[model samples]
Target: MVSVRRVLSILFCLLMAGLVSSLAVGYFSADGIQWIDAVRIVLLAASTGWLAWGAAYAFNGLLSLPLKREDKTFELVPTSARTAVLVPVYNEDPVKTFSHVAAMIGSLHALGVAGRFDFAILSDTRDPEVAEKEERWFQRLQLECGAHTDIFYRRREQNTGKKAGNVADFIRTSGALYEYMIVLDADSLMEGATMAEMVRRMDDDPRLGLLQTLPKIVHARSFFGRAMQFSTGYYSPIYTRGLAALQGTAGPFWGHNAIVRTRAFAQSCGLPELSGRPPFGGHILSHDYVEAALLTRNGWTVRVDPDLTGSYEEGPDNVVDFAKRDRRWCQGNLQHGRVMVAPGLKPWSRFVFVQNIMAYVASPLWALFIIASIAAPTLKGVPDYFPEPGLSAVFPRVEQGLALTLLVGVFGLLIGPKLLIVARGAISGVNETFGGTGRALLNTLTEILSTSLLAPIMLMYQCRAVLEVFFGMDGGWPATDREAGSVSLSEAWSASWWISATGLVTLGLAFQFAPEYVGWLLLVAGPQVFAPILIHVSSRSALGTAEAGLFETADDRNPSPVVLRQEAILAHWRGAEASAPAFRPVPEPAFEAADAER
Candidate 1:
């Protein structure tokens, strides 16, 4: 049976959905709607309703502030439990990956709790050269961190199930050595205090299977990167707190930057490879969500601590990189359709799967709505209400006020969460952490403008991703490009040519046939027209983002000790000369010899 809190949360979402859908239907049917308009209305309501549901979380989060429970301080809890800090790597730059490991080890040592944790470098690198680099870097990492720390390195010859498989292999082999495990991505970094605190929390709560930290984006230099960093730092907590309030014991696992109970994970998260081919039915790409569902199914509490500070991760530096990452996520999330109906899953887990699916599915729906609207002028003739049986009127009448209200409501739903989050922060004095009210307000506006312009671009990308996935295209796991860089105009055009073409065609058609709606269409079309410029400029560092006082977070302005340590370690690796020559492709015997030497 569902708890009262869960029931209330579900009802709240449903009520919001109903209200938004009713308003949308009323707006569309004001003129005794054509069939195309009717379909558009339904799609609009669904998309906007999702947005409204999220807004409800932010609002609820605001109200729950005073009632928020305080967490036990980490300093009070003795670090006695054994923890395995698992750093999973694919074919990634070894120097950068190991630097992150070194930073974490250093941070742990500084906390005087290094002995309580062990570090594992689990590699699934297919490239022989990269494998060799990994070996060299592992040696360097040990040398830098000294022999006192328990750091182990292993590489799998056959990359079976990718990351999930890699982790499962470790658990099956050596997971019993530790009481708990902290999973870190190649780019993930966390303060020693934060790591200790997570373990402490798990220790205090025996039923807690997973505890996820809210990782802020760091080292974001590009304009696009800065905007993401700023938004994540400022708004993610409000949204996350709201999710936690509703989720209670059933929270999300973002794969990395989270600690899991070894026994619980080994028991529940040994994912079975779905029966069939790629895309929908192969090895699960998005394994994190499924793992969380499995944990919940087994009655293990999965929680996210929004207030846990000092966890950090890097983001894709450009639009292309972001889309590439999203493509993989899209395939993974879409694949959840198969797991949604699995036996024993909690209702909230099922809803999470549905939400993940809609995150990608909504893009195509939005596209379809836009297309229907564009063609509505030509596709639908004059409405004749009297032609239908039981009709009381002849010509359909348009209600300008109703249409305006619908437009305003939709935009409000889309943009209100950010405003509410900002307001909540100010009210709770959380805005001061983000550099005070004046700075926070300015940053919010900047993020809003930037995100509004980027939204359509993302919509098109998501639509393409969804279509490609449905057509059985698999986005293979690829290492994300975290290096700061800018794309040339030609590169940008190559990536966004479809957007430009769509914008031009959309504007042309609107001007030719639906001149009255051209202003409205421009909101969707204008950004596409300048896609190349937006992509190019946003990827460039010279945008004076810092000078313009655009995207500054408290962490950015005043670096935490762990962040400072990470920066120092990164600099050390970058500045040091290559200790070993680049591994050249050689015969199998030579490779074996190299492996033996290592």
Candidate 2:
């Protein structure tokens, strides 16, 4: 006989599948409401659902505002508290990763926290070339910056569990020496003060298993990069804070830029390799959220301190790059379903999984909905009115203002976050906080325009990921080249044609059936169909040429990010005239651990 869990899982899967199939059949059957009208209803409902969710998310963010810390102060901790900083690296840029470590080490030593904190470079790089680079960089980091701290390097002989496995291995063997472990991504940077503060917070709040920070985007040079940076800075906080509010003890773990209690994590976060095949079965893709859920389920608080600063990460610089990164996320998030039905899972865990599923699935649903709305009028149907019984059994009716409803909901949800960010920035009088209202508004417009175009492309990409996850495709942690700044048109064309095809199909379908709406929607999707060309020209070099009046540029129109000016100036000054201020390098320190008395 099958287990109870398996039986329930089978029943739930069958139920969901049946519901979806019934909807699909009803929408497509010629004998039902005219095919066109049926399609329209499905599309309209799905699109509306997406926009509604987005609105809910916006409000959720707003509601969480009161709970967020407004005054930022670093909580100082005794460095001798047996703390270890864990930097997990997959195939990542060693130079860039080490540069961050060097910077942090200097900052910590400056604050007298170096002696208290030890550094661990836990690498899971599988590629031989990347692994070699990581090794060389670790040694260089030790020579250049690790002397003052106890620096340890360990590469998994087999990168069996990806990041979670790597962390698990460390916890099992070497974790007992440290009271807390600070986790950072390969591209992540956090100040020593923040690290010390996190340690302090963890110590003070014994029930707190994790303390996460809002990571600001840094080193954005490309047009897409700047756009993404703007969005991350402006909009991420609200959503994050909202989630934090709801999850006073169930906050998300974004895998990095956080500190975890060693004992709590070791006891709670041993992720079971999901049973079954590839993609969904073998290894968890987005392990951070799952780990956080596991910890939370065990009565540990997972807090997000959005007020904490000095955390940073980079964005994928272009459209293609963004989608490439998203493909993996799509797979990972979709795979959350495995745990969604697992026994002993928390309600918050289910909520996170559902939210993740919608992130990817909603795109395809919207695409379908958009197509259906346009085709509705063209369908040959029976009499407009048909009903039965006292309950008035009937299909969902098509609203005459369907298009307006769709646009309002989408714009409100997508545009509201930015507007709120702008309002917050203006109210606070922090011009640089969100790159100013002028830039924020412009960024919002650019985002709306760009996302609209790219939506179709992303829809196709997401659909592919969905199918792949269903069919078992692996999106293991790929070695990302942080400095791999540019992509050729050939690369763009080769990678992005599916999106182009999706756009083209949308255009074709819309034009054929919904000519009235097709013109407007096509106008939106045309650039997205050829996003590679548009995105490339929007970069810095293109901005320079356009600035030179090559394309009839009249006044000085600068799209360069104002927030980057300070950092850019520093870089320029360091490169041009003098050497950057050099700090005393950290000398290798020793550690002694006592065995527990028998």
TM-score of 1: 0.90
Best by lDDT: 1
Model 1 bad stretches (over 4 Å): 1-16, 22-26, 66-73, 383-398, 474-483, 578-598
lDDT by candidate, in order shown = 0.81, 0.66
Return the clash pairs for model 2, or none. Answer: 43-369, 79-116, 91-479, 147-586, 147-587, 147-588, 148-586, 148-587
Give the local distance difference test score of model 2: 0.66
Instruction: For each of the candidates, give the backbone clash count.
Output: 0, 8
TM-score of each: 0.90, 0.79
- Tens-digit lDDT string for candidate 2 (139-226): 7678765677888888888988888888888898899998988888877777667778887777788899999998877666565565
lDDT of 1 by residue, 1-598 (tens): 2265556665766676677667767756755667877788778767776776777677666666554334334573685689999999999998888878877777777667888889999999889999998998788788777565889999998878899999999999999888999999999998887898888899999999999999999888898998999878888877787788888678999999999999999999989889888788979999999999999999999999888887999998788889988999999999999999999999889999999998899888878877777787666766556776886777655556766777787778667778877777777777777778888888888888988898888888888899889999755333433335777777788788888899899899888776657887888899988887888888888347576567888776666666666666666566563443442211234223322321
Q: Which residue pairs does candidate 1 place in steric collision?
A: none
TM-score of 2: 0.79
